[model samples]
Target: MDGSCDDVGGERTALEDVGVLLADQGLSDAFFLERGLVKYGDAEAGNLVVVQVDEDGREHELVTGAGEAWLELRDAAQAEGVLLEMVSAYRSVERQAEIVRGKFLRGLGVDEIFAVSAAPGFSEHHTGRAVDISTPGYGVLEEEFEESAAFGWLEENAGRYGFTMTYGKGNAYGYLYEPWHWVWG
Candidate 1:
């Protein structure tokens, strides 16, 4: 697969090659990346379901139908001795903006932050269908996660729960490869 991890029977796929999963069919109209996020607004957000992240009960919200799959995936991993944890999930536009604002305060320009964090409305977290996962040893959202046992577990089993790793090594999304960021399809 070289730097690109998405391969389809000898061919490769990119973001444009697939549909971006949203919180619900209704959220398709949220907002786009270039316009920049001014506010967070999802009509369906009110009905989002909050689920326990793991046995310790960290809570995270996702669209109505995702909680069960998350639990199922967690249980599956636990069976294999992996303690799954959530670093982030269901972020709001305001939260995303705050993250960007914090980065800027620390000297990162908008373009620099955009390369790593999606501008408010453009973030998958807006849909509540995306989650940044973590295992204790690898830290959160680090490239080193790719070398962990948890990463291998996800690569092998996440699909059965309808989860997919969105960014690959040379992905076209411009975001860095995120072995920890997964979208529930």
Candidate 2:
């Protein structure tokens, strides 16, 4: 990935580009920008990218992981019959900005907004090192997915593949506890 805004045609680069841009803009303390995609649980830097077929049957290409951690994780989940599926991945910086703006408009305070939205150029999706996985028939990150055998298997084995949960209980950094999200280290 070029990770440049030009390639994205002013749509803002992927989350990785946003992270880099934010670092250049001096918001380093707010969040650490991710570089590439990885499994949803890897602690290494980067955003989660995934490929998903939406309910509309549209194939969406997501930027995630620097290599094959995502594939391995997906395979592991499948081997266990966990029924894993990706919902969203590799969000562009422009899209992230829009999400932030939407949240702001929806009454999220400045701090609250930043807590969830990457301040442009400071996102991980640019690196294609992150992923969002869920069980089939589950709407997004449903509670069942969070507690399902697939999730548990990942939690127990993702680290071996350099993947870690991006957010979960007791995590004080970046967004809320998203059981469905992971990153490759």
Give per-candidate clash totals.
Answer: 0, 45
Clashes of 2: 45
* Candidate 2 residue-wise lDDT, 1-185, digit = tens: 22432333245334444444445445453334342212222233343333556788855444344445666767877787766666655665566656654554355664676555556545555345656777756557655667677788887888988877776765555465678877665
What is the C-alpha lDDT profile of model 1 across 106-159, one tens digit per residue? 556545765688755568788878888899888688999988999999999999
Give lDDT for model 2.
Answer: 0.57
RMSD of each candidate? 13.5, 8.4
- C-alpha positional error of residue 21 in candidate 1 after TM-score superposition, expressed in Å: 28
C-alpha positional error of residue 145 in candidate 2 after TM-score superposition, expressed in Å: 3.9
Residue 18 lDDT (model 1): 18
Worst 10 residues of 2 by lDDT: 35-44
TM-score of each: 0.73, 0.62
